[model samples]
Target: MEPRSHKLYHLHGFHSRNLLDTYCSSKAEMPFTYEAFMYPMEKFHNAFSSGDFRGDVLIDFSIGPQIQHLYAAQEHFRDIILLKPTEHCILEVKKWTDSRTGAFDWSHTTTLATELAGKSDQSEEKEIRLRAAIKHVVKFDLNQENLTGSIGLPQADCLVFWNILEAISKDLKEFVRNFRKFSKLLKPGGRIMHYGALNCTFYMVGGEKFHFFKYNESDFRSMLSNEGFVITHLEVSQRKAESDLMDFDSVMFCTAYKE
Candidate 1:
C-alpha cells in the first residue's frame, strides 16, 4: 500500500525519552528496537575480529541520539568521527560522552554488547572507552558539497551508517547522490556498513509523523552495486510485531567495500 501523503516532520523537537519509548523501551511485544541495537554490534565485532578491515578512523553517519551502534568500533578504531544532521543529535551524542546528568542510560545495551562479544562484566569499562575514543562530533548536511561543512579530515577506513537513508532521503536518486558523497570520504577499498529501515514510509516520534523515502531489498542491493560497492554481507530481519507507532516490516543491514 502506498503511504498517504502528509506534512513530513523533521526531528526538530528530537525528544529523547519519547524516542526511547517508541523504539528502545522493552515493554513492546516485538523486540524490534533491541534487535536493531544488537545485530550491528555483533556484526561489527565479528567482522573486525575475523580480519574484515581495521583502521585508525571510522566515520559514523548514523541518525538519532543513540550510541549502541558504536560498541565494537572503539576497540577496532582509534578515532570515531560522527556526522550529525541536526543540533539535537549533536547534543544527545555529546551528552552521553560528557556524562551529563540527563543522558539516556545505555548501560543495559552496553552490557548486552559485551556479552555478545564473549566478555562479561565489562560494560562499564566499555562505556568509558567509547567516550574516550570519539574524537569528533561534527555537524553535517547531506545536501552540501562538503557534508561536514568546513571541517577537513582524513578519509576514513570505513563508513558506518544506521537508519539515515529512510529519514533524510525523499527518493532513490537523492539517496544515490548522497551515497556517493559518503564514498568520497572514504579511502579506496574502505569498507561500508549500512543499517536502515526497509520499505518504510514514516516512523513516529514525539507523536509526529515523518515521511521518508521508502525502498526495498532490491533497491538496496542495486544502489550499492551501482555505486561501486562490493557487497560482502547482507542481512534482513523482520520487525515481527504490529504497532501503530511504526509501520516498517523489516530492517536491512549490509557490509560492503568500495570497489
Candidate 2:
C-alpha cells in the first residue's frame, strides 16, 4: 500500500462527508470548478433514465456512501448491491437505504435527477424507489479473490462504479488488476460503467490528504482494451473545479462490455 492510501485513515472520522461536501458542492468559493464535475454526473445519470441498459441486477462499487449516482439506476436495475470497503461506509448506506435519521440528504441530487428526466416534483418517489431497489450493502475488497469474503454473489448483468479505482489503487498495476477482478463478477455480455477523475494526484478528506491515482483517457482506453473489455462509450470533461481541495485535470465516464 502507498503511504497516503486511504486505508491509513479511519473512514468514519469525516472522510465521507468531507469528500462529498467539497467536490459535490456547487456553492463553494470556486463554484465553477465544482460545477465542472456536476456536468458529467448529471449527463451520465440522466442517460440511465432510458431503458437501453436495464438489467436484473446491478452492482455499485461506491468509494463511500454515495447515493446520488444510483438514482437513475433504480428505475433500470431491479436489484442493486452496493459494495463499500468499510463497515462505516456500509452503515452510512444502510442509514439512507432505511431512511434513518442523519443520513446524508441527497434530496438535491434526487431533485436534479427528476428534473433532468422531465419529471419534476418526483423527488420523494424517486428516493423511495432507490431505497427499495438497493437490496444489499456488502463490505468488499478488490485484492481478495472473492472480493466479498466468501459470499457467492451471482454474476451481475451490469456493474457501475464511481471513482473507487483512484481512491484505492496504489499504482497502475493494481488499477489494471481491479478491472480484471471486476470482469469475473459479470456475465459474458455484462458491462461496466464508470465515472473517474483524471490527472488527479490527491484529494483531501476531513483535512487529511490521501493518495489519488494519477491517470488519463488513453490510459483507461488501453487498460480496458487489454483487460478483455471493448470500449463502447467514453466522454471526458476538462477539470472545472479550480480549487485546492483536489487537483484533477479532468473526469471520465466510460462504458465497456466484456469481450
Candidate 3:
C-alpha cells in the first residue's frame, strides 16, 4: 500500500532532516526515500571511465547535497564545482566537503562505489579522493540570468544534475526554462549528466510537502532534444517498493551533449 495514501500536501519547503535521513541515505537504511541508487551510480561510472566524457571542469548543478553522481567524474575531471540553490543545502554540503564536525555520513555510498569499481571496499581511500577532487561548493540560484554573477565563474565542460528539476518545478515549461538556463552555463558541445524521478508529482520531506512535475522518459528526452541536446546514454530503474516518503515509478539516468 502507498504510504499515507500518497496524499497531496502544499509544497512549502526543503527539509534538511528529510534530505539527510532519507533521500541521501542508502536503500538499506532508507527504503522510502532511496531506491537502489548504486545501479545508476555504477552506470555513470562506466560512462565516464570510457574516455568519451573527460573534461577540465565538471559542475554539479545539484538541488540537494548529493555527491554520489561525482563518484564517476572524479577520475574524468580535473576540477569539480558544487552549486547549491539554498543556504541550507550549501551548509549541508560544506559539512561534508570541509569535513566538519557531525557531518552526515555517506559510508554506505563510499562502500558501494568501491565495490562497483571492482575494488575491495576501500571506502577511506574513496572518501579521500572525493574530498581532494572537490574544488568549490558555492551558492547558485537558477532563477538568475547569471547563475554565478557574483563569483564571475567560467562555463563548465559538463554539468551533473539530479533531483532538482522535478522537485522544484510546478510545470513542464518552468522545467525547460530552468534547464535552458543551466545549459547556458555549459560550454558549447559540453555534456550534461542527469538523474531524474519518473512519474512523480509530490513527495514529503520532514512531513512538509515538496512538489514534483509529473514526467516520463519520453518527456525528458523530448525536452533535452528541444533544448539542443543529443542523449548519448540513458538508463532507468523501476521502483521496487511503495512508500509515503516519495512516490515515483522509476529513476532515470542520462548523458547528453549539447548540439
Q: How well does each candidate superpose onto the true structure, as a TM-score?
A: 0.91, 0.90, 0.90
True-vs-predicted CA distance for residue 191, candidate 1, Å: 0.4
Please give, for residues 1-259, the per-residue lDDT of candidate 1 as tens digits: 3344533333344665666656765554535554556666676677767677679999988767767878888888899998877787788789889999988788767877789778877888999999999988888766578887788978999999887766766788877887887779999889988888787787777767767678999998999889888999898987765677667788777899988
After superposing candidate 3 on the true structure, give the runs of residues whose Cα lies further than 4 Å from its correct spot: 1-12, 26-29, 32-36
Query: Please, what is the whole-model Cα lDDT of each candidate in the order they appear?
Result: 0.77, 0.75, 0.76
Give the per-residue lDDT digits (tens) of candidate 2, residues 1-259: 3435553322333456666666564454634433434575575575575455678999988667787777778888889998787877778778888889887777767878788778888889999998999999998775577999887788898898788877777779878887677668898888888888898877777777777778889999999888888887898877765568677887788888888
lDDT of 1: 0.77
Q: Single out the weakest 10-residue window by summed lDDT for candidate 2.
A: 5-14
- The digit string of per-residue lDDT tens for model 3 on 202-243 reads 776776656777889998989998888999989888887567
Q: Worst 10-residue stretch by lDDT in candidate 3?
A: 3-12
lDDT for predicted candidate 2 compared with the true structure: 0.75
Q: What is the C-alpha RMSD of each candidate to the true structure, in Å?
A: 2.3, 2.7, 3.5
- The candidate, 1 or 2, that scores higher on lDDT is 1
Q: Is candidate 1 or candidate 3 better by lDDT?
A: 1
